[model samples]
Target: METRRVIFFLFDQVHLMDLAGAVTVFYESGCCGQPYELRYVSPYPQAGVSCGLSFTNLEPLEAVTITSSDILMLAGMDLSKWNHADDMKWIPWVQAAAATGATVCSVCTAAFALAVAGLLDGRPCTTHWGYTAALQEHFPKAQVLENRLFVQSDNIFTSAGISTGIDLALYLVEQDHGPAFAYKVAKDMVIYIRRDGAATQQSVHLQHRQHINHQVHQVQDYIAHHLPEKITIDDLAALVFSSSRNLTRLFKTVTGITIGQYIKELRQEKALQLLKEGHKLSWVAQSSGISSQGELRLLAKQAGRGRLA
Candidate 1:
């Protein structure tokens, strides 16, 4: 297998986690047999990181020749301390890499750098939620999405905040090596295999789990674990030792979704996953607890329409 090159473009006062998080993901992914040649480049001889540490002996960005298979990541830095005259030198290099069909990505405020390069103009992108307003104000042409973990437009990708960089890197891994390999990498890293870029900042499972109701949580856990089996409201209510009617009311109040809707959403999500693993439609429906392939197909069609809307 030809090794894919991943290069990090570092600058002064760069967020340490934004840079290190992605590096760790890529490194751990390599342990699973994904061949990646990681490199660090900067305009300066050494780059100061936000955590009072520095990356030294970095290759000069101008000296490197980016290729089509290369992934060039721009690390987030302190926007207030940025020097436009000095930093503007890197913009042309970014454009050059993009022109070569290399995948360009930004972590957090690094989207600002891409915007300066005119690469993000008229593209759907996002930055840290705190900076989303500023990003929109500066780049009026860019559609800055709020509360998104990441956004991908063509070969350009942008992610929210510091830790979401790992999510984006794992997403890239999945895009390259399939979901099974990406899941293995995520498992090795002890992190969830995050949803797609279009997903909300928090997943449905995580979003609905912030309550202190242990009994309701028990029912949620049962549903998640027993998706392949036939589950009913009575079964969930029995898990919590409550009447079905009361359980339904409590579940809706806590999760904001009725029990039936939650189950349907879970089944649809599971069906999508099984399909991604190359399973047949009928098998996906069976494994995801959908009654038949026809139901799965209708759900998929509805999902497609939602995306288009």
Candidate 2:
């Protein structure tokens, strides 16, 4: 097989795993060993590459051209804070790259970047769940999938958050090589699950939390804003024009947890943040709406801080 170039477009606040996971999977598969070349490219030569945070040393995208690459991957980022001025500059280059017949792809929030280039318009695409609603708002013409891990429409591909980049890479491997080769690479990487796009993103939700009512999200938001309030299912249902039972079902679907469990988890997740910021366990409990330090300790234990003593 002839050597093919895989260029990664890195930028300030770029998601690190989106680039690392894809590059690592392909490199470890021996795809890069025989006929593949992997390179990191960024728009700013001095700005450097950071995975939504800080960085060390990275090359500039200007140093390379996507025209020469077999695959051009636009790593994901925070779409809410994305500026069109900074992003629009790359549209012409991306459009040109796509015209070259090279596969252009995005992982998570990177899908928004691809959409900016007009390449993803009228195509099936996806991004990180946190930004799915925003993606739809921006690209009304594009069919932005919500539940899938990734979507491949023609030569353009888009994936969900963080680890899904690996899944996208494996799909690419299967396309460029074969299923057997892709499987071998997955095995070497110790990846036991290669989730298809249809896999639900709500896997983290416990069974007790699987409600599907619209009011659930509304109630959750309300609870989040009023953490000090003592909320109940009935109180939440009253706000949504639905009965308690119906609200519970909807809550479970939207949040993947019952109202009580979602509240507890949200409180606990917030407690940990407070604790790390030097808040005492008792203070964390009070601020997080829990009753006692003992309950806080238990929540901490459930959060995997059991060793905190």
RMSD of each: 6.7, 19.7
Compared with the true structure, all predictions reach lDDT values of 0.84, 0.71
Please provide, for model 2 over 59-169, each residue's C-alpha lDDT reduced to its tens digit, 9 standing for 90 to 100: 665566666347988888655456667765677778888888888889878887888788888998888888899989988989988878788888888998788899888
Pairs of residues at least 3 apart in sequence or in different chains that clash in candidate 1? none
- TM-score of structure candidate 1: 0.72
lDDT, candidate 2, residue 232?
A: 83
For lDDT, the strongest prediction is 1
